[model samples]
Target: MTDHHPDPAAPQPGAAAPQSACPADWDPLASQRRPEDPPLDVLLSGTVFFDIVFTGLDRLPEPGEELWSKGLGSSPGGIANLAVAAARLGLRTGLVAGFGDDAYADWMWHTMSEEEGIDLSASKRFPDFHSALTCSIAAQGDRAMVTHGHDSPEPMSRLVQHAPAARAAVVDLAGETDWWGRFTSGDTKVFADIGFDETGRWDPADLAPLAHCHAFTPNAVEAMNYTRTESPDRAVRAIAELVPLAVVTDGVDGSYAIDQTTGEEAFCPAVPVTAIDTTGAGDVFAAALVLGTLAEWPLEQRLKFGSLCSALAVQQFGGSLAAPGWGDIVDWWGSLSTAAQAGDLRAGYTRGPYMFLDDIVPDHPVQGRRRAQGTFAMRSDAGHH
Candidate 1:
């Protein structure tokens, strides 16, 4: 793994410097819209956590040693990572999760519903429940986290019952949630993901939910262990037998995917970028894949898009908020194309792989999107307390 961290002298919150303002809004799906289509593009339900991320750590502290991290950030995490990622990519996203009445919950609610423009019509606020919180120690492109929170007072089935209809939904098969069946019944395509099995059992029954899913995305290790395959290629093929679309993401090596729906299989290489923090790179990848799939793009392009988005995400710090918007995509492509034209060998190879993006990215100017903040203070509450 690449050993890299943010510069210690950088800003405290989010660790990275402030990003430029991105376009207020841009809908990539406008061209494919139909009058009868669902109001939301993606539906998600899970716990939302107030994440406190510490970056620039040289190493984990020894038992008796104390270490001061050079960077810090605060944002909504857990399911919110996927939610913000999809929304930033111009998907009309809705979230069904429980929230608390505390300050942390209030900040996350404002960030997701107001700042991020995610739909929270189905989410509920408990009277005194405290919002979930995670403290992430980031170093060497990976992280260790300590989280404190409780399960939603109400079952996810209860919250999802009121969720808006959508074209697709992202489900964690590990959650063993029963609501995806209801979604599939309504013609919503389900994209499933599985969490690491700490039990090491790697039981096949854990994947029973794939029967209702349109696609399944798992990391290389998880896929290999679950399928008992020797390699990601074999794992993806085996997984495809269970779900129409099987995606195995190998960090830095890129992603491999097989789409039985399109009779296409492809491997997209990871875009090389200096590592900062890889907190939510996987979520970013899944969001990009969902966008490409919903748009009816070719399977190869879908993998490539997902790889590129995740690459962009890891170049920054934080999780949910670090996800790139279209403006970020535009900037990355523009820089690459310029470098390629100027005879940069590596840039040429990278730009050529994503040549498909030439036709899809917006040609006109677009605003830069929101960046991760160090604090949860909302402008509306400013000067009031």
Candidate 2:
């Protein structure tokens, strides 16, 4: 497992002068696309969970009563969803995670590293430990899940040790602050989100990461709790003071964001979709946020794109596998025409991102066997093998 240990040289926020803008040298690819020289656009660190999902069940199983699910499938879940979401959106994404060399881990790692095009150069493997597992059951409009696993051998903060200089990083709020400083020192945009606080403490210190994060996205409750504010707008304002851009997402009411750069705020209603399962919607929401910010689009446009993406994600069964890609977005837009708009927001939102559609080539490997089974071994704990 990747160690959560801090890198001795990891820069601390405010310890040095702000990272300078683009350096003197100039290569079109290096200067513009990869400002940080990171081989990938985003390098993420989180736990990898093997998910077993059961869908299409009309109701939850009664105590000891037999139940039949209409569908059953499996996929890589947990923070893996964020990595897959970014990759599907055309971002060169990498993930630093830990894995046990069990059957579930083998399949999950192969599916993510091979099928998804995510760079797992910083990931580590423990042949003896049992990989994490999540069993999810979907019934009616809701779902229940139970996860089993031990903590990763290392904390997620250690990813910076092995990852290249990425333009942005997706991380949790309570995670290591040192990585935030190190990443930002190279002009890497750190996008941070907070986890649920069952204790309801919602410490203001949790927002400490915002000091280094280029953007901070928290759900309505998380934002409100952290800010001690009642409304999403207030929460956004309080947070905007700390970060360049602050977003507070409210389920059906929509999402609110304040762009400190422009002093502009915007809100977009959630796309009303017959949700099948909302397992990975939040992660999908964060993915759109990352892209919209990177593309320098308007706050309203970013919110709309995120809303649509999350709305689409829940319409499928599995977690990360349910993430919608550009292909899915275009298809959903095409389907909207027949629905006659009906206030579902069919236009404007798709134009900016959709314009680049022609450039992406579908991931269809022509010849049989894209790589060898031993290919997973190519990645060494020594870093970026």
Winning model by TM-score: 1
Flag regions of model 2 displaced more than 4 Å: 1-37, 176-181, 337-385
Evaluate residue 278 in candidate 2 and report its C-alpha lDDT on the 0 to 100 scale.
82
Residue pairs in candidate 1 whose N, alpha carbon or C atoms collide under 3 angstroms: 21-368, 22-367, 22-368, 22-369, 23-367, 23-368
RMSD of each: 7.0, 9.8
Task: Please state the error at residue 262 of candidate 2 in Å.
Answer: 2.5
Tens-digit lDDT string for candidate 1 (1-385) = 1112212221221111112111125678888989889878899999999999999998877689879999888889999999989987888888888999899988888777765667788888999799999999887756788989998888889878887789999999888477667887668889999989999999998888788889999999999999999999999999999999999999988789999988999998887788798888999999999999999999999988988889888887878978887778888889989999999998898788789889888886554555565676764321121
* 33-90: candidate 2 lDDT, tens digit per residue: 6443656677788788888888889898877898888787677888888987776666
- Assess each prediction's global lDDT (C-alpha) against the native: 0.82, 0.69
TM-score list, all predictions? 0.91, 0.79
Error of 2 at 132 (Å): 0.2
Please list all clashing residue pairs in model 2, or write none if there are none. Answer: 2-154, 3-154, 4-155, 38-165
